[model samples]
Structure formats: C-alpha cells, structure tokens
Target chain A: MSCIPQTDLTKNRIEEISSSLAEPAWLSKERRLAWEKYIATDVPDPKADEWRTINLNSLDLSKLKTTKLNPNLGSFETALPDGGKLPKEMSAALKQYKEIAGFIWQTEKGTQHVYLDPDLQKKGVILLPLSLAVNSHAGLAEKYLTKTRKFSHDNKFSLLTEALFNSGIFVYIPKSVEIEKPFLLGFDFVGNTCEEAVFSRLLLIAERNSKANIVNVLLSSNAKNINASPSLSLVSQLNELYVEAGAKLSYAELQDFGQHVFYNSRLNNYVHKDAHVDNLSVAIGAAQSKVDVATYLQEQGANSEVLGVVFGTANECFSYNTIQEHNAPDTQSDINFRVALKDQSKSMYQGIIRVDKKAQKTEAFQSNKNLLLSNGAKADSIPKLEILADDVKCSHGATVGPVDPEQLFYLMSRGLSQKEAEEFVVLGFFNKVLAQFPVPHTLEWLQGIIGETLCTQFQSQAELKAEAAVLVK
Target chain B: MTKTILTIKDLHVSVEDKEILKGVNLTINAGEIHALMGRNGSGKSTLSYTLMGHPRYKVTKGQILFHGKDLLVMPADERARLGMYLAFQYPVAIPGVSVSNFLRAAVKAKRGQDVPIKEFRAELKDNMTKLGIANEFLSRYVNDGFSGGEKKRLEILQMALLKPEMAVLDETDSGLDIDALKTVAEGINSLASSDNAVLLITHYQRLLNYITPQFVHVMHNGEVIKSGDSKLAHELEAKGYDWITQELVAQA
Candidate 1:
C-alpha cells in the first residue's frame, strides 16, 4: 500500500470503503484487484497523443479527497414532485431535472435515492440501487459487472473508479419487454466545501428482443465562489451498457456541471447480433471534462449510430474520444460529432472506426465538424480508421472553420441582431444530428441548452457595450 | 406631388476596393413603380445593395436618404427596421431556421414587439395562400433547397409580410419562368399601394410587361444615362444594349 498524502485514496481507505458498503465477497475481491491495478498504473503521460491537448498535471489528484458519508444522508428531496427543502441553486436545477427524467436515481452529498416508475415495475422491469442489486440479481451482476473483458483498463482513472465507487444504479429490462417511456438517471456530486471527489457507476442490461431508452444527466452543485479555491470538486463516473441479440437501446447522456467541477466519464456499449443501438451525448458545462464513448459490434448484422454535440464558451475545455469497433461480419456504424466554440474556449474530438480481419462486409462512417466563433477560440478534430479487412468500407472526415460571414450577413439583413444571427446558424449546424435523437423532447432540451450557452456568450458582450455607451453618456 | 421615399445623390460604392457603382443618382416617390434597366455590369445590383446598407458596398463618395434620414450610416438591420427592404438577386439560405420563425422574428424586429402567435400564423397562411406558396414552406428552413422560382416567390412573400415603405427588387425576375414570373409579379402588384413605392432592377423587360412601371431609367457605366417613360424599357429590349451604347458613342 503506497501512502498518498492529502487524499484518502490509500489501499486501507479503499478496502474500508468496500467493507463499509457491505458488498459481497466476490465484489470485494474485484475491488481489491482494481486497487492493485490502480496502484500499478501511473497517472496518464501528458506527452501521449491522446493526452497532448489536455493538461493532466493541472489536476491535483492528491488534493481531491474522497467524499465522507453523512450519517443523516436523506432521500433526494429536490427530485420529488413537490419540491422539498433544498438549497436555492439545487432546487432550481432540480425543477428542470424533474421534467426530463421519469425515473430518477440521484446521488448527492454522499446520499443516494432510487425511484422507479410503478407502471414499469408492474411490467417486470427492475431498477434498483447497486448495493441491493448485488444480492437480488446476484447472478446477473456477477456475470456482467466490470465486464470490459477484452478492453483492459490501462488508464489509471478507470482503475481508480473501480476501486473507489460506492454509489451506483443497476437497470435491467427483461426479455421481450418494451418500455414506452424513457428512464432518467441523474448522478450529482454536490458540495459546499472546497475539496471533494465523487465516484459513481451505472450498469444497464437489456435482454434479448427487448427495447429501452434511457437518459443520464451528470451534474454538480457547488458554491459560486468555489472557483477561487485551488481544489474544488471532482466527479468521476463509468457506465456500461449491454444490448443482447434482437434488442434495441437508445441512450442519451448530458454532462452539465458547474465551473468548479472537473468531470471525467466513460460510456461503453456492447451490441450483439441483429441488435441496434442509438447513442447521443451533449457536453455543455464543466470547467474541464474528458469523455470516452465506445460502441462495439460483437456479432453479425449489428448496427450502431452515435451522435454528439458540444458547445464551449469562455475558458471551458472539453474533449471527446469515440470508437466504433466491428468485431463480426456484416456490421455497420456511423458517427457524427459537431462542436461550436465561442470566446476563448477550446475543444478537441478524436474518433476511430476499427474493423477486424474477420469482419467482412463492414461499413463505417465518421465525421467531426467544428465552428470557431471567435479568434481566440480553438478546436482540434481528428478522425481515424483501422481496417484489416480488404472487403470492408470505411471513411472518416473532419473540418474546422469560422462561422460563414455570408450566412451572418444574410441573417443580419433580415433584421436579426448579430448574436441572434449567429445562434440561428449554429443551431442549424447542429440540427443535422440533433434531429436524429429517438426521443423527440431530447432534441428540444438539447436546443435549449445550446441556446442558453449562446445567449450568455453574446449577451455579456451586449451588456459591456451598453455599459460603455452609458459611461460616454 | 407625392413625397420622395428614397433619394440617392452621386452614390459611389466599391467592393474589395474596386468601384462598382460610380456617381449613380436616382429618386423614387411614393405611389410610383420605377424600373432601372441595365446590362450585366451596369451597377444595378450594386445600387440596390448599397441602398439597403450592405456592408460590403462602401459608399465612398455619396449619400442615401430614406425619408430624409441618412441611410448610409445605419447598419443593414437598422435599414430593414426603418422600412427599407431588398429582394436579393441571390437569397441567402439560413438552414434549420423555419420560414415561419424567420418571418416572425423579422416582423417582431420591424414592429419592436412580438406579434401574437395566432395572429402571426394567420397572417403567414393568408399571404402564403395568396402567393400560391404551400403551407409546408412555413415549416421548412428559410430559403434552403428552394428552387429558383420558389426563392423568388419567398422574397416577394417577405416583402408582402414586412410591408416596407420602399423595396429595391434586385433581379427578382432573372431566373423565373414565364408562369412563375407572372405569379411573382402579381404578388408584387398586390403589395404595391399608394403609401409605398418599388424600385425594380432587372436586365429583362419581361417582368415590366406584367407589372407596368410608370418610369424607366437606363444605366450605363454605373450611372443612369437616360430616363423616360416605360417605352424606354421596350426600346432597350427591342434594340438591345448595343444600340443605346452606339448612340451614346456617336453623340460623344
């Protein structure tokens, strides 16, 4: 056990966390192995190609202490229909949170609550806390938990999450069952203090011939002045999705946290034969965020479509790495991720489509488009393909450019202000992919988030000009 | 006598530092339909764009006045809100912004308040039906993927919706077929009234046959070289631009 100062991430503390959760012997052993891997693997090398743009040294892992569980941890009060007593900022965010999520499971301030729709429960769907699911669905959990069998975790962050996660949810859809309404799961790491780290996980299993839709929203609540502190809060999450043969799953995720938060999340989906998966993700908030999304087509006749939208303003930094891997014959994958950058913000996208030797007749497509709205704004887009099969069809493309001046002048000629003109053009640029979401309301919600970001960006400039005009007056 | 709606005094406009409109002058009063006809490079489009306050067309040597207010100093959108409209020769496509939303926003900006939704929808439907435009266009992105005739009709539709005090139609009739030209001409004719005026910039006299202009002007070398009744458009269409240029050279 290596001693690490300023953080409770030592071996003893990790093992104690496992014991405190009252996990089964197998799970405890699993955590111990993950801890061993965490200690063995060093922090990511900044010079590595994937980590070149990101400043890994700035994140002081030692200062990010593990969250202390409060004995009086109560249910998620703000999630109720009639809002219970919560802080002003939390309650305000929850009002919007309630509208998108039908079934809510939120972990905040070291407390976790699980809510399942009664109609869904009657239909034999199971949504439970991860702790309870270990005993109730022991066979299922044991088989699939930490099931990144072929893709080993060479990164220290994944190992750290596996070793330290204490709060999570398990969602299971039975065979041939279809839920009309999508499920919503929220993981919030909130704190008033300066130093805290929250680790959470999600494991979703869709059985054969079943269909499900889920929306996961990751958020954080922190004091406005917390940015002044050298170390504020760290939110780390991992989600694994398993879609069986002849099944379909639509998953959408949104990462919206405060400026005082650094969010790290990974989403991995495995699709079997004749199954379909649609994944959409939107990243708009956070001081710094790194997200990895991977979809593996594990059998013949599988298809996966992934779409992502990211908007960055001010000094926010976001990176998205995606992979579409075809392991079997007759698989198809398509991916498109668009980013709009304004102010002095920066963004980068790395996408890969891999087809193995045996994966003949495979078709894959990927693209990343970026719009830089300001001179100081920067963006990097890289699209790669690894094709071992001569009979496969694969293509990738990327583009980085400023907003079209002609388009802006066109809108301005129609009596729209410059800001409104830019917002309209940007929204149109993203709608090519946003309109593809399976859930209709999700498109509207994503548009609202993009709209708010643009409004803040241009409104501040307008206010500054107005103040200057007043001073001259 | 009617009041002058717009007056340009020796307007010299340049794009990329190359002078496109040099010392051009024109005037239009309320209740008048005037057509400015010229050859391809005769500065007709440049004059319209400069009058509409397009930033690319720098008014280096002259002034444009709308209702006695200097229009050159105003931005493009400010010119639009001040009852000046330009039907572009090439309408710009704003993808993902619905036609209905665009019109509503334009109406709001012109009126300085949001038009009630019900009222706006009713107005859009009424105007669309009148112009032979289907209701489906209201849901589509503005000018995106529309055919030549469709873009022209949409321009006229916007002019009708905005009801500007003065409109500069820049080659709105160039790419339209005979049937579409008549339909668009009727749309323009419907919008024309005693309270507003129209300045038509076109290379052909086909549109003038549908909507008769009370006055016609010939443009050469970025200036209006001749002004007469509608017969001047007919004379130009009959003899082509060479006949006029030959006469000008002979006289010089």
Candidate 2:
C-alpha cells in the first residue's frame, strides 16, 4: 500500500503507519490531505472564551500511535443492568459513515471498527470510510474534511489529526430518505495494544426533507496499554446535518473511555427553513474531554435544541460549549445542560445564543445547572446572549451550586437516606430536561447506568440494604 | 384507654429562639378525635410542626411519646414511620415532581418497598376521586400550582394513603371556599376511623360544621386554657374569640 506520506509534515511517519499494514496509494493520499488540513488549522487559544477552560497545550501527542489489533479479539457484549435493552431512540447503524464516499479514517487493530448499515447504501445514501472517500467521492468529502479539524483552523493536535488521520465514516443522506433508527457509530479502542494514535473523522450531510437519528459512542473495549499516548483521540466531526426545509435530525454523542484518556469532539449543525435539529449528548467517561457543538438556523421558523446530561466524577475534567446562531426570521434555539460533579472533578459549561438582525421574533434560551456533590468539586458556568434583533427574545442563565439541602431534607424526611436524597434531587433536576421532550427509554436506562455509582454513597447500610432488596425483587 | 398513641408532657417549643409552645401537655389515645382551636398566634400550627419534628422548631424542653415510644429521640422520618402524620396548612411545593409521584415515594418510604404500580395507581385514583380532586391534578408537580383548597385536599389524600395513627391537621380548613372546604372535610371524614386519632387545629368554627370533632380545646398564649365537647365550637363561634380572651384574662 502507498498510503504513507511522501513529505515530512508528519509524512514519513505515515508509511511506517501504513507500511505496518502495507501500502495503498489512495489511502495515503487521503491521510495526506487530512494532515494538510490539520496543519492548516491554528492551535486553540486561551483568548477564545470557548476554549479557556480547555488545556490544549497539555496534550502529549507523541503518544498517539496506531497499530494492529490482536488476532483473536473476544466479544465485548454484556447485558446492561436490569437486562433491559438500550434506549431504542436512535436510528440503526449508519451507512452514512461508510467507505463509499470520499472520506478518510483511523482505527486501532482488532477493535473500534465502524459498521455501516448496508440497506442505507441501497437508498442512494453514501456511507464511506473517509480515507477511501477521498479517492472515490472526493468532491463531497473535500468541502468539509478539514474545516474544523485541520491545524491551520485549530492547532497542532488538529494538525496531528490531519497528518495521521486513521478511522472515520462519511455519510450523505440523499433527499427525502427517512431512516427509522439512529445511524449508530461505535469506536472501540482496543485494550493493551501498541496503538497510540487515534485520529478519526465523521462527516454527515442530510439533504432536504430527510430525517434520521445519529448516535456516536466512544468506548475503550479493552484496557490495552492504559499508558498508551498519542492515546489522544482527536475526532474532528463535521455534521452538516442540514435539515433542509421541513427536514429533521436528532443526534446523540456519548463518550466513555478508560482513565487518563484525552478525547476532543467538534460537532457542527445547520438547520434550514422550518427544519428541526436536536443534539442530545452525555459525557461521563474520560480523564479529560472537550466538546463543542454549534447549530445555525439558516431560514425562517427553523428550530434547534441541544440537550445534554453529563456527570463528572473523581479527577475528571469536562468542558462543554454550545453556540446557537439564529440567522433568519422567527427561528428558535434552546440549549439546556444539566451536569452533576462529584469528588474532586471539575466541569465548565459555556453557551452562547446569538440572534442576527434578520432573526426577528427569534426565541433563544440557554441555561446550564450543575449539582456539586462534594465540597472539593467545582463547576464554572458562563451563559451569554448576543442579540442584533430588537424584536428577538434571547435569555441566558447559568447556576452552579450543590443540591439544595432543603430538597434533600424533604426527600429524606420521606425515608430516603442522605445519599439517596441527593441522588433523587440531582436526577430530579435532569428529569426536568427529560420531561421537556419525548425521549426513548433514556431515563430508565441511564438511571440504571448511573444509579450504581450513586448507590455507593449510602451512609446507612439500611438504605443500601433496602436498595438491595429491591434489586433482588 | 385504647393504647395511648401520642402523649405530650411539658412540651416546650420555640422558633428562632422565641418560645412558642411553653410547657404544653396533651394526650391522644387511639380512636379519638380532638380539635385544638385558638387565635392566629396561639401556637396551634407550631404544635403541629413541632410534632412533625421540623428542624427549625426548637424543642427547648419536653418529651413526646408515641405508641409508648420516645418520639423526639428519633428523626423526622423515623418518627413518621412510627405512625405520625401532619397535614400542613401550607403544603410545600416541589417543582418538577408530580403529585402522584410524590405520593408514590411517600408510600414506598412508608411501606419500604415498591408497591405494585397498578395497585398504587388504582389506589391514587380512588383517593383523589374520593377527595373530589380531578385526575389531571395527579400529573402536575406536587402542590406546585395547586389552589388553596386543592392543596388541602391533596394533604388529606396523603393522610389517607399514609394511614398514620395520629394526625395533626393544622388549620386544614383555612383559605378554602365552602365547596373546597366541603371536599377536604369529606376526605377527612372518610379517614375518620376508630383506629386513628385526628387533631384538627383551627381558628374558625365553620370547618367543625362538616367534620364533627369529639372534643375541642381552646388554646391561648401557648397553652390549651379551656376544653369542652363538640358544643364548645358552637359556643365560641357565637360569642367570637373575644369571649375566650375575656375568659382567659379573667382566669389569669
């Protein structure tokens, strides 16, 4: 395979990366283009309020290495607590991130494979691996390949991703094809492998009047070297989930990785006239994570909603930024993020709602609330609104505090312990956001997923024993 | 007597350091209904809150015995589990939590298990209907948007489900229109049984028109200065509270 780069802008390193698997000219060129874009983007600066809390300079990219997976990988399937199925809200595995369309990618050996739904391809949907997409579907892929992930646009890691981009999926939804289930994207970082670098990209473009739910999940299927570096997973995702006139798009991004893992995500969305875009995400499993989601309302009556539920535990650090841009008349945008932080964890939420002059009668609200479980835990919230339209209604609110003790006392006075009381109150806050919209079985599943962590805090063996009895029942 | 369910002796209570119930003494056996009537600041509500073990109501001195067990020694929830319930004049509103949901948690906390969902729902429906509360009320947050009458009815509904042996209804009839007042009275009347004791605290004599009490105690200046049967409510209503003030001052 001639996939290795010819130049030294992180090029020579490409052959060793590709020659390790053998040369493929088309694959090398795709990686080369991605590297160029990554190098082109600027390093995120502290001056940018959105990236202030994010420690971009602290990343050790020299550790991100990619190698082959073990020969015999075991199944990573296990029943979720209660043996109940996961929330079935998302559309099925996406064919939109396949190798058919011009897009390049990165993946570790023996794990973290991207599976595209074959049926979607038959519907004229192009789901291609990004690297392969460059040779086969270059036109569409080139437009957004490095717009967000390239170095010139961002920094060295962004450049590093462009230079050593490995695994990803590119999806193009043809006009008017509605996918029933979410297009599911799963990245399984294999355990104890020589793989260091993880540079991945996923492009999603939906045409007018089409609809689908996309769920992107990151998981460390194996603990493979817990110390592995370039252990960095720089995922530059450009989702032009353009909900054309009357179209709809629902997306969920869930990140869960091993300790000390560095994960960064960039999500972009554009909603057209009378279209709807919903981005629901949960960030729980990383040593450090930074997520930036931006939504643009391009035409009249377009709507965008971003709902996030995050829990930061132990020494974890989470940074979340959301931008709601109202470009047209009568557009609506709302971002509600509820987060809970425990132990010494830290959380930062910065949300901006901007309404342009043409966006008269625009309605936008941005709010973030945090529940600090421990005295050492800290949360920073900065919610702002920029309005250029006099007739628009834009408001932003941010609050960071521990759960109200009075509420806890109320629940406890009803027989819950101090810990159970806090859990109830924290979950109750998120329950407000949950009740605002129609979600799948997300509440029940996430409850089971999150309850275990909270259950350990019971001071009274009585409460724990009571919970146990219920569990047994 | 039918196993004294509640016994309060020299119960001294205070709020923000101001003594409210000064050395009060009271006793309620199982299967008894007693009314504590007094003017606005006569410590009737304070007595109810103190019994419920509200943290703010400082019990400067006193021992509250319930079912022959030490009441003040236990926490509020433990005290509740021991069969004591209080229907607040102003029920707390918890936003985002449904009325039925709050009831369900209270039920589980009282029962210590997940009651079969269907049975719980059916019981809630029956109780709400019995209290004349609309079914839509169950879906709203607990007392969040409830009118005065609805909050009172919901309190009785909870009292019905919780089935506490000794209940302290603190002016349950306050702020209610006649129709809403009737709804609450009817709910309390339904809970009237030989196994439980009801302490209906009030200032007006109208609520007595609906649910007749076995006895009425006229509380004044942190102490019940006068006691009588159901007829006392009528006598006080006819002469107004000033008559009691005259009698109290004369006694002093």
Candidate 3:
C-alpha cells in the first residue's frame, strides 16, 4: 500500500477508505458523519491561550495523503514474516523487554503480527486488531467505538482521526482477570513519500474487578534513508480507556517518532466507581508535538494518577494540556508533569483541576515543573484550580526555572566538574517522577534514554569548543 | 617540624559587594586542630565559605595559599581535589541522588579514577558503622529530608570518605545534641592524622569540650584579635566574649 495525495479532504476519500475495508454500514455512516464534523469544525483559534503557542497554520491538510490498509493478519507466529521485518532501531529497542504477556506490531501498511499467551486466551482475554475485532466482537466494538466520538466533537485533529483512522488495536480483559505481565502495542510509521499521514486508534476496556497493564510505543523509520522530505510526514493518534467499577488499569505511552515528524495525540480515560487508573506519557522525539490527556472520575471512590516526562532538544517544540475532572463525590485525582529542555527547545504546559459542586470531600492536585538546561531554552507553565465544592481539597503549583545554581555548586563542591555536576542534577530532577513508574523495565529504559541524550549534548558542545580552538591557532 | 598547611594573609572578602571578611589573617599547621570562635556576624562562616571558593564570596583583596599554591584562583571542585574540604553549617539537599552514588562520584573525582564496586561498598559500610549510621542511609537521597543530626553525620561521613588534608568544619556542631556531637567528634578524631589538619569553626565552646583544640583564636568584627592556647577556650566559656571585645576597645 502507498500514500496517494488527494486534492482535498472530501466525503469521497472517507467512502473509499470504508469501502476498501468493507466496514459495516453503521461504521461507514459514522465515518461520513465524522467527515462532515471535521469539515464543519474550524481550526483552533491562534489567538486563544491554548493555541497561541502552537502554529497549526503551517500544517496543510491538502498536502497529507492517507495510506490504504492491507487485510488484517490474525494469529501470527512468534516471529514476524519475511515481508514484515521491523526497522533495525525498532528491533533493537524491542529486545530490551525480556518479559511481556503479548504484543501486536503494526506499520503504516497494516497489522503485521499479533501474539498472545495461550493461557490468557483461555482465560477470556481478547487481543486483536481493531478492524478484526469490529467483525468478531461487533457488539462490544460498536458500543465503545461510538462512545469516544461524543467526547472528541470540538477538536479538529480528533475529528480527523475519527473519520480517517486506517489502523488500530483493541484490548479487552474479562471480569476479575488479573494479569501480571503488560501487553506491548508497537506502532511504526515507515513512510517513503512526502506528506504521508497515518491516523491510529486504541480501545482498551478493563471489566469489573479486573487488573491489567498496557504499554504503547510509537516509533518511525529513520528519515535520512527515505527520499522524501522528512519534515512533511504527519501522525495523529487517539486512545480511549475504560476502567469499569472496582477495576484497576495501568497505561504508559512512550513516543520517540522520527526527528522531523509532526505528531498529535489525545487520550481520554473514563474511570468508574471504586476503580483506579495510573497513566504515564513520555515524549522525547519529534519536530513539533502536541498532546492532550484528560481523566474523568464519573463515580464515587474513584482515583486517578497522571504523570508526564518530556525532554526536548534542538529546535523541537512541545505543548501539553491536561484536565482532571471530578464528577462524583469522594473522588481523588493528581497530576504531575515534568519537562527539561536544552538548546533552543521550548515547552508549554497548561493544566486544570475542576471539581463539581457535588464532589464533596474530593482531593485534587496538579503540578508542573520545568528545568531549562541552556540559556536559550524556554518554558511556560499555567496551572488552574476550579473548585465548586466548599469541602474539597484542591491546589495547583507550577515552576519554570533553570538548574539551580546552588544545587550545582553543592554538587561541584563534592569534587565533580561543572558538566558532571549539571548532569547529576538534571538526572536527579527527573528521577523523582520516574521513581513512581509501575514497571521496572520501563523505568530503566527511560533512564537510559535520558542519560544518552545528556551525553550527546555534552559531546557536541565539547566538539564545538575544540573546533574553535583549532581555528584560533 | 610540622609543615604549614594553610595561610590567610590580610584576606578581604565580600558578599554582594558588602565586605564580610576584612583583612583577616590566620595560619594552620599539619596535625593540629584549631578552633575559630566568634559571635553570629563575626565572619567565621564567611571565612570558611571563601576558603572553599564559593562564588558568592568575592575575594576583593585577599591571598589564600594551600601548601604554597594560590587557592583563590581555583574553582570549588579544584579546591576539593587539592585536598581542601568544608563541612557546611547548612548542608544543601540534592534530591533524587542517593548518598552512595554521590559519594562514589565524589571519590572518583577526587582520586581521578573510579574505585571498584567492592572496595567502595566496603569503605562506605565501614565508615557508616563507625559513625553509627544505618545501612538504609546509603540508599536515601543526599541530605534530603534528613534531620539536623542526620545532615551533620552525613557531612562527617563525606569527610571520612573523601579524606581531605585540610578540612574545615563550619559550625558543624551548631544544631547537634550532646550524643550526636560525641559521635561526630569521635569520627573526626578517628580520621585525623599527622599528615592532615582541621579548622573547627564554632559559635560556642560546647563542641570544643568534645574535640579539644591545640590552639583557639577569637575572631571579632572580621579579624582574629587574639590567639592563645586551649586554656583560652575554657576562659571564654567562663567569662563570655565581652571581656575580649572590651579588652580590645580599651587598648584602642
């Protein structure tokens, strides 16, 4: 399958996608309605506070063409087929995980491999491609897939993903089933042409009294190997998570796309009574990326914890918006987001904790911390608290500053050089948040990436200095 | 004959352009423990900070020599590598960096090479046991959320691990209780040797009672007005600082 440019985003493109996949009539009609909504909705107003930092004007929908999906490959062996080889870097990355219950690997073309432990299958766990699940479990698919549309109506990017998503995965954990190992879902975008666009979706459901963990990894082929302009490729993704009553779920996403890709994502978590959810997002690679994550506590005794770690370098820009809404009494929520920037990179974070009038005895908190590693790096944080209940405990805190000179001095006083001192402080700054990661392997992987990035930065600076000395001589 | 370890000649230092150390002159010799006692604003801490190359303490007009090498030109890390250590009165906390990791890095930097894991662990365990610190202290972040006594003990532990030649204990006994003071004093005594020297800075004579000093100097208004034997400490404890300051004013 290849990406072919369409003159415009029209109903014909949506119909073509639906017909090519032989989608059910209800889904096809839903796609047409979503297409109309996408066309009718206006781009986010640049003058607004949330959109001011993001420049969507540079993104032209006409230039991005969607790829046609191949037929779903169900129940593949442990090894991928000859034609379904992953990129070398992705393969190397996957080798680091020694234990996982199962994994589904997909590229822009389509799902390449799907694997699950037979024991899990016997226990009534369902893991398959979204396209395949729609046919095999039509009742469950239709109910949850349509539920996401109600919350994504006002955003242009969300509407686009709803209308044109060609690849996705569906995961279901039956009632009272507890799984110790996490399921890995890998998405690799290997575009060989400019303006290629990929829209992916994820639907996860943890039934009553169930427990599960899910990890989503987003990667892209190295741009230097392709003949197309790397900066022109686009990726849009949406995730829908449902944690039913008395259930528990842990979700983590690690995004390290190609160097020059434009990426956008949104995650919506619906947590029910007596349920708990732990969500973490790590973003380290991309030219310009925007993300929105929201958690809704819809019943009493519900709890949610959200965490984010962002590291940007070079001329990359990242923007994040988060919401913690307490819709029921005795609900609890907390959000902690940390960002570190170097070179001329910039970051913007906006978070709000909203408590309804009836959410008495609620506990909500939000905090965003930014560390600038260079003089040119910039960060802006905005935290808001909207509490309508008098008995609720709510607070928000935000900080934007460079590495503390005193901390650096304290470390240096122990005999470390300036560079080594700064590195230690920066790593320590992020370790506070990383210590909370539920999975040990994920924590180790993130630490390795952060360490490598710091080394690269320091090495380049040393090289520049050496070159200057040579010129002077 | 004992060798000269440090010399401060007509030293002048400033903080934010305000002179804190004015023409303060003193000297320390190898193997000798010296006590510097003064009031709150008498510039004892300022002198300690300046010796450790704190950037905020500008040496506007001063000369500090460590074993005949100019100390003012070197940075703090270089000063540390040159066998100079300062136990701050208020140790800054570095969150998320475990004590063991920080000590390992510091030891590597000071020795200019990495020590093997087995040796480092053994050394840490030995020192912790001697100082009465639990094994859990090694895994905790460096001085983060530590009680006053714990912070002071960690400082001494670092001094024990680094093994500097010229150590400066800047008001290390300020917030410690009697039991903690004895433990820290014992640690210092065990680490001291004929090849190294210590300059103990304190406000009261309480710490001097535990770790007896060979020489005691009284600093007033940024200058060492008088120097005497260990008896001077006992005298000051009995009569207080007013007699010394009054003697100086009468002479003027």
lDDT: worst 10-residue window of model 2 chain A: A78-87
What are the DockQ scores of the candidates, in order?
Answer: 0.73, 0.47, 0.73
Q: After superposition, how far is residue A30 of candidate 1 from its true place, in Å?
A: 2.3
Local error of candidate 1 at residue A383 (angstroms): 1.0
Q: Return model 1's CA RMSD, one decimal.
A: 3.0
Residues B158-223 of candidate 1 have per-residue lDDT tens digits of: 898889999889999989988889889999999999999999999998999999999999999888
Docking class of 2: acceptable
CAPRI tier of model 1: medium
Docking class of predicted structure 3: medium
C-alpha RMSD of each candidate structure in angstroms: 3.0, 6.2, 2.7
Alpha-carbon runs more than 4 Å astray in model 1? A1-5, A69-80, A83-102, A110-112, A222-225, A468-473
Model 1 chain A: lowest-lDDT 10 consecutive positions: A70-79
Candidate 2 chain B, poorest ten consecutive residues by summed lDDT: B92-101
Model 2 has a clash total of: 70
TM-scores of the models, in the order given: 0.94, 0.83, 0.94
lDDT of 1 by residue, A1-473 (tens): 12234867777776677666666788877777888888888777776655665556546777877765442353533234434554332343445444433455465544455566666677778886676677788888888884753466565776777877767778899899987567776666555554567777788999999998888777664435455455546777778889999999999887778777777787888999999999998887877778888899999999999999988877778878898999999999999899998878888888988899999999999989999988988899887778899898888899999988878877777687887888888988887788887865677666776777678878897798899999999
Which pairs of residues collide in model 3? none
